[model samples]
Target chain A: MTVKSKHVRIKGIKDGLVFLLDDKCPFEDLLSELRYKLEHSHQNILTGPIVHVDIKLGSRIVTEEDKEAVLEILKSQGNLLIRSIDALEAPGSKENDEALFLMSGMLRSGQVLHHQGNLLFLGDVNPGGTITCSGDIYILGALRGMAHAGVEGNEEAIIAASLLSPTQLRIADIISRPPDEWGTRESSMEFAYLTNGAMQIDKIHNIVKLRQGLNVFKGV
Target chain B: MGEAIVVTSGKGGVGKTTTTANIGTALALQGKKVCLVDTDIGLRNLDVVMGLENRIIYDLVDVAEGRCRLNQALVKDKRFDELYMLPAAQTKDKTSVTPEQVRDIILELKKEYEYILIDCPAGIEHGFRNAISGADKAIVVTTPEHAAVRDADRIIGLLEQSHVESPKLVVNRIRPGLVKSGDMLDIEDILQVLNIDLIGIVPDDELVIKAANSGEPTVMNPDSAAAIAYRNIARRILGDAVPLMQLDRKPGAFSKLKKFFGMG
Candidate 1:
């Protein structure tokens, strides 16, 4: 049952293109329409200047497969970006570069952040929430949640937090939790990494020197 | 405008129907036009629990398949004039209704009623998806147990992936005695694992069965502890900040004798 006839308006925003859809249409139909629009409007997919496609669902509930389809379509564009429904609410775009994305609000339980570059949070990563990144993850607030860096298998990834108490922390293949003696304590910045074939944490300020020390130790 | 709220529990026998009945009754008592839609399909129990089984002329499957209008399937409640029930089909299966049909029905209902409470089927399959498709918000009903909590965690993850924001949690069948004795999981433990906002905690009460059997929800009786909890939950949904009620323990013989003897 392919329900077509859905209207999708595509326009150029600063960062990328915005695809505003009719609220009543099914998400799958919208994605199909988006594909049709791109193929018809640009004549060639590779030459399009659209760097991202921000979908404004507008109170419509989207299915998981529909979301995956949209992601898949955007993935084909190579540099095309896709963001969450919340991200499209403001309707602006920026260049895709290696930069930090700082989320200033509370990452409530069950919320997830999946990014390829560095991620910084100024709020608590509550329990049941997750942060997955290819680069490093820095939480300026409490990190009493889950954090996975080097999701693409970069072993040099590090996760740092002001209050480094997480349910689980992973860097590449190494996964670890705080020691049993560790309890709720005063907030302090701590950096975590795969050290000596295990996950270890140390004061963030001493990380640079520690890396240098590790190099010197390897030389010896 | 009315909002459809689906009460779902991924695991069976976890009080999804009980929550739906009580919350629907409570909302009706508040003078809101409410409809409790049972989406369980073949294993339908909401009609029996709501005491409207005798009145179901057309089930939800019939409505979805265009066999009947939405109004013809809606069974009016015996107790409250504003409360109604849309029972599921016993012969047909869950596949009879699609998520699109549910969404269309809810959108139409929103223009007429004040609240739509959907009694969801157990499991995270098509039935569950159809129940939640039309809902504006969701109430995940889970008991304080390891298996239930784990299933709830999975449901929460699924809801998040589906973009259902701020789905509240209701912990049902809590036994304060067992919790005090450390034999059962506490509310805090469930909250720590599920990490969702606690909506209500219904104590384990034998009266729930009696109420369900009678087709009269516990929320109708002020004396029933489960009913009181359900009422408080309904009020909380309306943005009321009612304090949680402390569950009363059965008094021991020593306390009864002390009272009878009029001793300090």
Candidate 2:
């Protein structure tokens, strides 16, 4: 029989498969449902070559232990290759955007990545590419394009990058100075935040001092 | 089996057709049997650029529609017997040909030609889809402009989505003088955004315009700087690691002495 519960659903995208887990459901219930599907009907989904499954936690704040548990359950199935674990926009912002969405890969031109909660992108953002996050945004690689933090108007949200030469930067509703005024590319790491509705650029070293709450958020 | 390489640029006037024509001829000059397939369909121009416009008895639509054999539609190049051109049908739109048809035609052409280079159309639409459908690899041609490089980045993203393995990049119509003056984007800026391996960089040369007007590709001119660039690209396609041609237009301090001494 089919697992009629919407807690764990396997969806298909262009490249491969995706596992969409319900955000409202308890973590234990979602895990059990996932295990049941894997133990029973995985034969229908996981056939032929290896399947790349990206698990999306919709605005659900899953701790490191919970992530490991999910990974273990998915890995128990022989044919599934866990591609990525990330978060997406929840149905509504009834609760705060606590889930941190993680993504790896460069964002090329004309590509815009939009996420609900805090976001961490581990690759370059080419010119014309965009990343809009409802919370803080961090880039492990260069950020050459556009980045808008606190899309839902969270003024405290900040954007940080290893190499922050963005065409434009935005925090909440405040936009940065014109691109030409930003001058040439600087290879050093930097962070952009809003002070009294004006965007300010600062070295990444003082990010924690400016935002004392980042420490509380970082562990997530 | 021979590899099918599609030359594509998301933006127009970035030298996709010119790149296709020159690279096809350069490969032919290297004694490799090459075919150029024009997938622009309604606005076919590869034939005119290749100087084989008058020789097209049948076009790609005719071949795909089963009205003629592939050989009958193929226009042999006047400069090289080993090179061929499959012109697109000017009357028919891109929808007249399907991706499946293009793939099948390319697969059929692969048996005879050592390299099949498909010239993709400008916009990322049906024409672009059909052009890359059968390509085993791809070559993205772009100019050293923000708009061109941006469109190139989009094309690369689409290529990856289509499962076409890493497409090589060719920066065409670059002017070193302007790059040095900071008036234009340099290869470094373009490469940074593109994030793909550079196959070649073609300098903007007046000879390219003259050759295209005469319905001849720059690669056949031999003395043209663009010709050398295209040759390097062809050799690179053949897996040769030829270094990029010298694009620095600033005459060396010893240029006059070297010219007087008859030294290259």
Candidate 3:
């Protein structure tokens, strides 16, 4: 029986049951297996007359129709009900690291956050906190720590922050530090990027300068 | 519920034990039921600094290992009716008590006390982890030296990762004379580096040493400048908006003479 149906795995959680469906399996095969399991083990799975189960479609991009179809299959079982349905998190990448990540709180010294794609931070990176990403890095608060963008050698990646007074800034293979007199605590947004094998820091108002720098590098 | 605050400093001898003793004593003096826990197991000095060294029957290891009751291990302060100290075991290492056990012991203490201050051991080792296991807040102690401030930054990172919210800063043993003469890191400089809110700034006062030698915290001596600083910190802990003390030094006669004549 187990060999015939090897797609959906169900487990008991505190609030209710959780159905973890293998993304490699076909949607129809998973739905039928879920229906059979819910009908066969409803008494053992639930002490109550009615129960809600959460379906985690790991990495499977589910449309509204797919969600409705899954719900319809559970409704046919009569005993099980749908609580929450989680679908694929992001597009264009099989790995979750490619998705945009957002985090808040004080990123203190000695802590390093590495992301494969664009990262957004809503807190201060205090002194020693390091942010290393293969893509763009955006910070809503002060970025006083070390930020290394395009760790995988993506030169187009930019590191931007509301207060970009970092200890060190690295874009692709280029590394640079701000001048000694650059400790102005202004509330303006600043961004840093690599151009012509050097790192350049500019205010957000001078965004055209960044594009011009990139174009000049391309021309060279 | 009572607050469990851990006073920690990654670098040794920056006055974690001294700050714990003074702040705990000051809070108790302000009528808050406070308990000081010495989590620095092997090198226990909070008991010595609190002047309750003679009254240790059972230690932290005893309470954690279930050898004695929690109340049996607590050494009551003779000065304050509501203050208590849980002395660390002198013979045992940091591994004697686990973080979970420390949390359990603090949970029990929280019921009876209004404030629980854990004097953490230096370094990001088992003792420091155990000290912050049950802390709702943290107080990072540091001197105005480069090494101490760097270590404090590292400790603050660890504290943030452990979910200890908004760890306040206490710059200890700051020499105003050196700061005025451009030889020391002032409060502003340290604040710029650490980026944490300042709770207290204790000057390099002789009274702190004299009080510690007698096993009494500086907060008990009203004549001491460090005492006033600790009292202000304690009051700030109680949600009072106390202003920081002015820590400027008066120029001596030598500096005055230098300014008066171009060549003497």
DockQ for each candidate? Answer: 0.06, 0.58, 0.38
* Number of residue pairs clashing in candidate 2, backbone atoms closer than 3 angstroms, sequence gap of 3 or more or interchain: 0
Q: Which pairs clash (backbone N, Cα, C closer than 3 Å) in model 1? A: A15-A93
By TM-score, the better pick of 1 and 2 is 2
lDDT of 1 at A205: 72
iRMSD (Å), candidate 3: 1.7
Q: Mind giving the per-residue lDDT tens digits that candidate 1 earns over A115-204?
A: 877888887776667889988899998787799998888788889998888889999888887655344455579988876757777788
Query: What clash pairs does model 2 have?
Result: none
TM-score of each: 0.65, 0.75, 0.68
lDDT of 3 at B3: 94
Candidate 2 local distance difference test against the native: 0.88
Count of clashing residue pairs in every prediction: 1, 0, 0
lDDT values, one for every candidate: 0.80, 0.88, 0.86
Q: Write the per-residue lDDT of candidate 3 for residues A102-212, one digit (tens) a residue.
A: 877777778888877889988888777899998889999989889999998989888999988888899998888876534544568988877788777778767666566
Q: Encode model 2's per-residue lDDT on A1-220: one tens digit a residue.
A: 4566879888888878899989898888899889888888666877667888899988897777788899999888777889999964343453556767789998988889998899999999988899999899999998989999999889999999998888889999988854565555555888888888878777887788787766545453
True contacts kept of each: 0.00, 0.88, 0.62
True contacts kept of 1: 0.00
